[model samples]
Target: MADLETLKARKGAVRRSEIPSNVLTALNRGEIETVNLVEFLAVDHAKLFRSTRSQLSLDDKSAKLIAATIKKLADVGVMQRLADTGQVFHQVLDGSEDREAVYQQLAAHPSDVLRNWAAYMDAANAKLTFAQRLKRAKPFAIDDNMGVREIAWMCVRVPAADKIVSQIEKLHPFAKHKNYLMRRFAIELSRPCGVWTKHITALKERPEIAQPLLEFCREDETKYVQDSVANWLNDASKTRPDFVETLCDRWLSETNSKHTQRIAHRALRTLRKKADA
Candidate 1:
């Protein structure tokens, strides 16, 4: 929600075109000290620069410079401040692979910062090979924060799905994770059609992969997880109406739990309407 003037000011400025860069530059140039940077980012996040770092399409040079600046701050004993501010961490991972190196330096830092950083780092754009990117992102997909875990799955899914042998089979184990978010993450990733992401070109025969996820989620208690499960089924109904109808009809007949029944029924709404017609 950056104001017009603020956005205009950012558009042409080579050093800090994005709000995150503006804040980072101000700290890097001594215009504002670390304390001021923290106040501007973490505590007083007013409406002026509400755009997250990912929204700002920063040029290569600026991203590298900001990565260096973040490293500088960490070296200067203000690493905790960088970890504390969502904006700071957002910029750190905003399409820049260099930020991964910075995170490596702060590997022993708090989980909050690591999880936040893990959420946005796009390994596909990294300088490393595909294997290396997977190596880098694999551990974070199970991060403590649900959002972080979701994001980590996103970073690896496309590339890994296309390249890895038996990728869906390998990922099935995540459904058994203790945290409901990780379980949800596994279900969503196995989706036949991408939600916002590119369609899984490799998963041509979709129903085989989708069935297990639906079964695993049928008994889930977390409302958030159930919602995702419902959405996943809804997405499937568009291409596999028969499969969805059959699954829902079976689940409805077998399960008496209101929550699971509600989700399954909702997912089958389109097919049900078609059947009525």
Candidate 2:
């Protein structure tokens, strides 16, 4: 458990000529806390730090020193890698104190780094807990369009159905952003037998909000939304025959191609069979 003082002291011992002046000063003045060090290494030197083997054009001594510093920081539980992207991947760690501290230090001030780090720390080891991710996702919903996309992708990656439902609920308010997030959610939900019935019921209650998702399912679109709507209709056909028939008829009458019309036709046939039975 390395604290701020320990990190600062260690950083001070490094030769001034070896390290950058600002970085050295940040250490000597105690300005480089553990959070600051973690974020700096994670963002600035992340590729070098995480590499199993080094490729940088530096002497062995400098590379070893830098690598040693990164290992020490990681060993102290200040930073962690959540997943591997083969070449490189995302790392999540704490930030300095708040937005202001980060803004003054990092190049891209007050950006998605904080939100991403927070979410990653919350769920890094505990793959089952989505509480932290959900809470962080809410704030990002109001700002940062890219944050919304990242959070939406996170939801899809989680294995739990309930977490997916919670993600959809959190992101529903942002459906009007026109950023392809809502459509992405709809596509994920449309997978057959992937999510629980309770999740499907929640989506059904917001047809008005979800209407835009239908457009993604058109024949020439080639989006996941298209097959997703078909899957949703198929699922609804099992129990809500009348609702399925009505929705299918509405979709069929629209001026879309026969490919899309075929989906509606299939739903109608299934509904008719269920009605007769």
lDDT (C-alpha) at residue 262 in model 2: 62
Residue pairs clashing, model 2: 217-226
Candidate 1 Cα misplacement greater than 4 A, ranges: 1-101, 104-122, 125-147, 163-165, 201-205, 272-277
For residues 1-277, write the lDDT of model 2, one tens digit per residue. Answer: 2554554455322332456554444433324432332333333333333341232233455445544554444434222332221002112212223322321222122323333433433333343355444444444333333433344345433434455444544444333335444544544443323342224454454333344444455452434345556666666556555666666667667766776776676546666675699
- lDDT values, one for every candidate: 0.54, 0.42
Clashes of 1: 0
Model 1, 178-225: lDDT tens digits are: 777667777777666655466664443466565666687787888877
TM-score versus the correct structure, for each prediction: 0.55, 0.37
